[model samples]
Target: MQDLTQAAALTGPAGGEPRLVAIPRLAAGGRWRVEAMRAISEPMLLWFTKGQGRITIAGVTRGYTAHNAVFIPAGVMHGFEVGPQVFGNALFFGKDCTLPLPQAPHLLRIREVHAQQEVNVIFDMILREMNSDSPAHERATRHYMGLLGVWLERQVAKAAPEQTRPDAAKRLVARYTALIERDFRTGAGVGEFAAALGVTPTHLSRCCRQACGRSAITILQDRRIFEARRLLAETRMPVGEIGASLGFTSAAYFTRAFQHLTGKSPTEFRRSV
Candidate 1:
């Protein structure tokens, strides 16, 4: 989860049109840590043209090389460490330009031969748009972004699972995630979440372990912590107010939880950022 706020500052304010940043060929022996994991807080369309690299997202690691393209949804923790340093371009757009996906926030890894070709072309188009100084550059960039969105939708459609196992445990965990995303501010406990999902607390814990690799309570806490971080980085609200907003009964408890997950207190994080 890269801190998008800082990235935005480094890149300067958003231009009237899609701004293109060309990362030229890496120096023969130089290494670059483009940005910390926390710097990438927004959804980004990324294309890798020439390099081998490893990306870690949400505790899942994947290796990538030349001609590989990936769509990283917003708010999902992700960062890349490149090997054989590569060159690519990233097109950052606001929510208005982003297209909806059938299954959201899942990384769409492009693998099909034809689909890879299409992705390559999109990368090339981005390079062309960056190089061209024509008056129509913005229009060209927007068109290519639209094309990229459509391509992503197609790739997700092709790659997404037809159906996940319908075990009751899995369903229960899925329902819990949905509810947390929708109603975390309600201060609901694990037992309340299980009851709403029509499962016993013990069953919910087991289901979460099998499906999400964590207990229901852990997932809920993570979501709250994530939201707390988002506000700390994005808003000027006071720490106590933020705690109350997230349903924390006391600011001290919220501070402890935030420190446990982020290794920094809310005020510390906000000040450092």
Candidate 2:
């Protein structure tokens, strides 16, 4: 295992007001690492402008390129592997200003050109207000945050429409999503998720793909990894204990699976971030 004394540098706003900070400022030069996964005590949004990298949450890893914004709720553990090419601002908001958000961590890919521009304006305003000497800076930032919340809600609503999916398929996948969130640490697999939903594994796969663009098994694995990353980064628990807690049969197997999806061994990753 890598040495634990050299932990990833953790940085954030140091006040009682909402704030925005450029990613490069947090990690100097062309490097970005928050590898040791840990929970954000406040609601934080990392909006990427350039570069591409993998982001794992709840065991689901996705290739996040440009124009991706990850909304992490307070208390949800997460990490990063962004580089210098990455250009964006990290918006940190107090719990009082955090808008109503989905209960789970959400990764949003903003593709619409006009919508992208709109968010950009809000980010600019936030940065300005965050660094300004005005007395209303806090209130102004909060107003901009509200706009952000609205835009994010609209984007989510636009991604999936009930009319586009068959009612039965929607219901099944919704239940499947919930089950994975609740039982992922149990080491449940695709077959089990299928069985619980009263459908065959093949049927589950088809429905999940049709409704969510990912397989049911993929969802379960992502949830497990999301929790695993948090445990590895936040605690000094022997990896074997973490693996066993997450329902991994063996430590070696856990390392392999975590590395496969996250692109780094748990030990190396925990230290790098």
lDDT of 2: 0.69
Task: List candidate 1 segments past 4 Å from native.
Answer: 1-93, 98-109, 127-133, 160-168
**lDDT of the structure predicted as candidate 1:** 0.62
Tens-digit lDDT track of model 2 for 48-167: 899977664433345787898888766554456666687888887775555675565677888889998999999998888878899998788778888998887777677656324337
Q: With candidate 2 superimposed using the best TM-score fit, by how many Å does residue 201's alpha carbon deviate from the native?
A: 2.2
Give the Cα error of residue 79 in candidate 2, in Å: 12
How many Å off is the CA of 1 in candidate 1? 30
Model 2 / residue 96 / CA error / Å: 5.1
CA error at residue 130 for candidate 1, angstroms:
7.0
In angstroms, how far off is 112's CA in candidate 1? Answer: 3.9
- Please give the RMSD to the true structure for each candidate, in Å: 8.1, 8.5
lDDT of 1 by residue, 181-214 (tens): 5566666788777777777999888877776456
Clashes in predicted model 2: 8
Q: Choose the strongest candidate by TM-score.
A: 1
